[model samples]
Target: MNTIPEIATRLASLCNEFKFVEAYIELYADNAVSIDPNNKNEPITGLHNLIEYEKRFLSNVEIHDIKVSEAIFAGSYFSLVFSMNFTVIGQGSKMVEEICVYKVENGKIVSQQFFIG
Candidate 1:
């Protein structure tokens, strides 16, 4: 079972490499929940649903760069600052910065919530 720090490290590495789905599949629990403020502020429950949501988003954007900060941990939770530069298909380029917080239980990430900045 991976510790919080270990999971955080792997998540950051995978995200930096643009392996978002891979990270999710490897680190998240089956019934994981994802809350994205930009997505109507509704929680997307289940790993399958979360992955589908991510895929939809990815299909609509051309990611230019991604920067993930070192994780800050407190008990079973950890947070990271993610800055992404991307272009929406047929739209325009934009940069977004967000604080991503994750909750880990029994070696798997059970929930993630993002705060856009």
Candidate 2:
């Protein structure tokens, strides 16, 4: 993708299509850092850890539907909002929403942070 909005669109498409792992592999830099909702929680550092974290998250998810909306791009930053309708292990139908932002450089995401709801 040539523009930040394009990149954000691509990422949103990937996640909505249940290709979350592929999105991470293609969009993130080698040393990308990912933070969970709370600052108190240690951020997942490095590409490998990021991939593993995504895999773990997806493995437990049984996607009924997913919607990605509100992608915003400004300079070297982008934000995407998502709502996932799914089921997790030991849980029934549930809806989870997360607001994610990325610090992007040279077309690859350098750092990402998530706020869960």
Candidate 3:
């Protein structure tokens, strides 16, 4: 069994902290999807767009009090809850929690989806 910690830590470090493009790209497949509740038009695809979209969001962003929960590792699928305090431009800071499910293969995420409320 592969440790979910490896993937989780990388994701947290890349997305929540450094916004490392290379690490971010390494996590997803060529055709990955991200569904965002805050944004109406989502499920964005492709690695380049994913990195660019993340860069666009994290350009002047701040996150705190991040917690991951409900992590279930079932072979090729991993699901977890990511909760954090986020501050974005134009939109004030708020504490939000989203459920993210990742489909993994060969230690890399092939597809990812987010369900937020």
Global lDDT of each candidate: 0.96, 0.85, 0.71
Lowest-scoring 10 consecutive residues by lDDT in candidate 3? 11-20
Which model, 1 or 2, shows the larger lDDT? 1
Candidate 3's residue-wise lDDT over 7-57, tens digit each? 866776665454558666667768777666655746787878888887887
Candidate number that wins on TM-score, 1 or 2: 1
Instruction: Return the TM-score for candidate 3, rounded to 2 decimals.
Output: 0.75
Q: Distance from true position, residue 87, model 2, in Å? A: 0.7
How many steric clashes does model 3 contain? 0
What is the per-residue lDDT of model 2 for residues 1-117, given as tens digits with 9 covering 90 to 100? 746777788888888889988988888889999888644557889899889888887788788999999688777999888888888888788888888888888888899988897
lDDT value, residue 25 of candidate 2: 89
- lDDT-sorted candidate list, best first: 1, 2, 3
Q: Write the per-residue lDDT of candidate 1 for residues 1-117, one digit (tens) a residue.
A: 499999999999999999999999999999999989978889999999999999999999999999999999999999999999999999999999999999999999999999999
Tell me, by TM-score, which candidate is best: 1
lDDT of 1 at 9: 95
Ranking by TM-score: 1, 2, 3
Q: Tell me model 2's lDDT, rounded to 2 decimals.
A: 0.85
- Cα-based lDDT at residue 84, candidate 3: 74
